[model samples]
Target: MTRRPNPFNQQAMEEVLRDLGCPESLIPSTISNYRLFVPLLFTELGEERVYQLVSRTRDELTLGEQEEAWRSSIKYIVAWAETVMEQYKHKRSNAPKSDSPDDKQPRLL
Candidate 1:
């Protein structure tokens, strides 16, 4: 793997979100809380799941650090987002399956 940067670059994160088709409304907060939940999301699910989970971006530190307030705020959002992602995964994985047996289904020519 390439050597990674600090994992918290402003412009790079914005560009990445743009590539992912994230909407403008979510661009700020989601990115701020991004690092908090990214690794956990990846490990529990996968890259695609990670993308789906982090649909927004935010800079929790919009004001000064002022203490640990911003960091904790980010953590809270990430935790909530993680629950949503997990629920979505469960729904997807348990979705209705095809009726035909695997090998018995006819393929298109």
Candidate 2:
């Protein structure tokens, strides 16, 4: 299968980030940095979640001028984070309780 160029190539991201005042030293050397970086947060919010966040931000920027695009992107990220937090909280609350014998209190002789 033919490989398509990554839409958010490293150089492009570096340029944009530099323009926005991110220190040149802090910019990642490649897009793969981001892909691998997300896993360090937690397993539940892994690479897939990071990809979804980037994709949503890209889609959100198509709505209008530069200022509006940035404004909308910020709003989108805030909403997305809230939704993810809620889903995680719900999932944790619904998880089955552990029933291991090791967790039971020991009887006094």
Candidate 3:
């Protein structure tokens, strides 16, 4: 089987956090959280389901007013998660599918 690209790599996580307007100071911890949480989410819920969940959470966060200061941080995290899921979906779609062994029959002598 072909190896899939890891979406939770440090560089990708940093980029997503930055793009989501995460505070520079918070980037490290956010990435660390992603490293720990995202894999578990995928393992338990599967990628597509996790993507859907994160997307919904992001939208809800976006719509709700940030009455508490912590809500802003939560928004950033949810947005980052949604973006990472989107990138994963894009990469998954573009990745080449492995061919079946039967599709590569040996040539006759």
lDDT of 3 at 5: 65
Where model 1 places Cα greater than 4 Å from the true spot, the runs are: 1-62, 99-109
- Give a tens-digit lDDT track for model 3, residues 1-109: 5464677477877887799998888887666666657744555565445555655676655544333544455455556766777777789699778797875635423
Best by lDDT: 3
Ordered from best to worst TM-score, the candidate numbers read 3, 1, 2
Checking candidate 3 for backbone clashes, the offending pairs are: none
True lDDT of residue 98, candidate 3: 70
Residue 69, model 2: Cα distance from true site in angstroms: 0.9
RMSD to native for every prediction?
13.3, 14.6, 16.0
Q: Candidate 2's error at 101, in angstroms?
A: 8.2
Would you list the C-alpha lDDT of every candidate in the order shown? 0.60, 0.57, 0.63
In candidate 3, position 59 carries an lDDT of 62
User: Candidate 3: global Cα-lDDT?
Assistant: 0.63
Ranking by lDDT: 3, 1, 2
TM-scores vs. true structure, each candidate: 0.34, 0.33, 0.34
> Which residue window of length 10 is worst by lDDT in model 3?
63-72
**What number of clashing residue pairs does each candidate have, in the order they appear?**
11, 0, 0
